[model samples]
Every structure is written in C-alpha cells, then in structure tokens.
Target: MDLNHSINFSSSSSTSSPFDDFIPLDSFMLPDCDPHLSTKEEEDDEAKRSSFTQLQKENIDLFWNQQLFEIQNTPVRKTHHEFPIARVKRIMKSDGKVKLISSETPILFSKACELFIMELTLRSWLHTEESKRRTLQHCDIYRAIRNDQLLDFLVSIANLF
Candidate 1:
C-alpha cells in the first residue's frame, strides 16, 4: 500500500447515507404526550385518572400522609376491627418467646397490619402504573419494596426475579 494514500472524501454511487433520514424531536413520543398516538388502554387509564376530582386526587395522592394525620388526630378504639383481632392475636402469640400479650396489643397490631397492607398495596399499584401496566404483579410489589428504604426488611421475602 502507498505510504500517503488519500482517504476518499466522497461517495460516487447512489446508495443512501445513514444521516439522510431526518428525525425531528416532535416525531419522538413520550408518556402522557401526543394522546392521539396512545393506545385504547392508555386512553382508558387516562380517562379513569381524569375522572377523579381535584380534592379526591389530592387525598389519593397523599394517602399515607393523610392516614398518618388521621391516626394522630383520632382517638384509639377497642372495637376489634375489619380484620379479625383474634387472628392477629394468634399470630402475635405464635412466637415462642411471647408469654403474654395485653388486650390492647392485638387491637393495635390488627390496625397496624391493616394500615401496612393498604400502604404496601398503594405503593405496588404506583409501580404497576409506572410500568404502564393495569395488573398489579408480584414484581410491582418487589419494585415498591426495593424503591423504599423502610421496606428493606421485606426485600428478602420479596426476591426480585
């Protein structure tokens, strides 16, 4: 080969160049933008979300916060619960070291369990929505748990696959 060969600076043939195709920024789609390009399911999801009034949306969006506020302001009750207090008591007493549990313990535990469940489900539902999925899968729960540092204790139980 020649020591000082000149590199070709031009294409003589009619084959199209890679950069010939112009891609405008508007051509690229993003979430919740360009509704005309959205699928039926996406439209339905949007409609559902839009159906909620501003106040309802605010309450839903700040569910955990609102729940904490209500708990702090409300008086404690001993009326058992929607969740069976007896079952909660049984589960608590299942531990070998648990010799005695106060009457109030089961009521509190049952309420706590209900609150925990609602919070976790809300978080997992958010993950499902983020993934643009209507169904709440196990992975959503795992993702929710992984995303929150406080839920790290559940990470071992909810293995990411």
Candidate 2:
C-alpha cells in the first residue's frame, strides 16, 4: 500500500533480480584474416569455375577439329570425262624443224583433265533421267568450274600481260 514498499531496489535473500544483461563468454576478436579466399567454400567455387572453363575450352577445340576434319575429308570431283570438252592447245614456232622458239600460253594437260572431270560431273547432275544426251556449252563448263574460276580469270590476264 506504500510507494516505498513497492519500489524495492535492495536485493534481499527472498527477492530474485530479473535484469540480466547478456555478456559473451569469449572476447569478440575477428577470426584470422586470410589475404586470399582460404575457406573451403571459396576453394570449391574456384575449382568448379576452373573445371567449367577447361571443359568449355576442350569442347570448343573438339568442335573446331571436327569441322576441320569434315572439310579435309570432303570429296573433290576430278575432271577427265568426255561429255564436257576439255582442251589445251600449244603453238610452238618452228622452221619445219627442231629448234624450240616462242610458244603460246601452254595449258597443262593435268589442268585440262581436271576441268573436263568437273564439267562432266556438273553436266551429269544437270541432265535429267529421260534426256541424258546434250551438247554441253563452253559457257556452262566455265560456270560449272568452281574452285579454279578465279585462277582461270587470272591466267587470262597473265596471258594478256
């Protein structure tokens, strides 16, 4: 009933104190500082990244190698057939006899053969099953020449020069 009686500040044997502030048993000190990420988690993450990069490099290399292999293994058609006309004319100056004089632009027999083969293959592909026989045009032959088209054009220039 008394104000002084209710506000009891002195701790006696009978009354328990409820104000208990938390205090850590050990003093708070930062754990040893690692200059680099030295934890197991960091190491695992770095290892995973390295492995992923290595795998990606290997896959890229394999893909490129396979592409190169396919390119190298592709079959190139040869020219030697009769369907498309392939000719190499060479004119050598002569006094009805032996001495070799100035000669015209000499087309190699091997190159002529290659041209024939490519031309024939293209003509064959273009020909239908019913009508196979047809006179292959020189223009068509030139058009069908795939790889050496530029070379042939250059040679024509060289002959002019």
What digit string (tens of lDDT, one per residue) describes model 2 on residues 23-87?
Answer: 55553565675767768878898887577556545654665576568547955334433333223
Q: Over 4 Å off in model 1, which ranges?
A: 1-61, 72-75
Q: Candidate 2 has which clashing residue pairs, if any? A: 79-113, 79-117, 80-117
Each model's Cα RMSD: 11.7, 22.7
Expressed as tens digits, the lDDT of each residue in 98-133 for candidate 1 is 989999888887878888899889878876876789
- Assess every candidate by TM-score: 0.57, 0.27
Q: For each candidate, what is the lDDT?
A: 0.76, 0.46
- Extract clashing residue pairs from model 1: none
Give the C-alpha lDDT of model 2: 0.46
TM-score of 2: 0.27
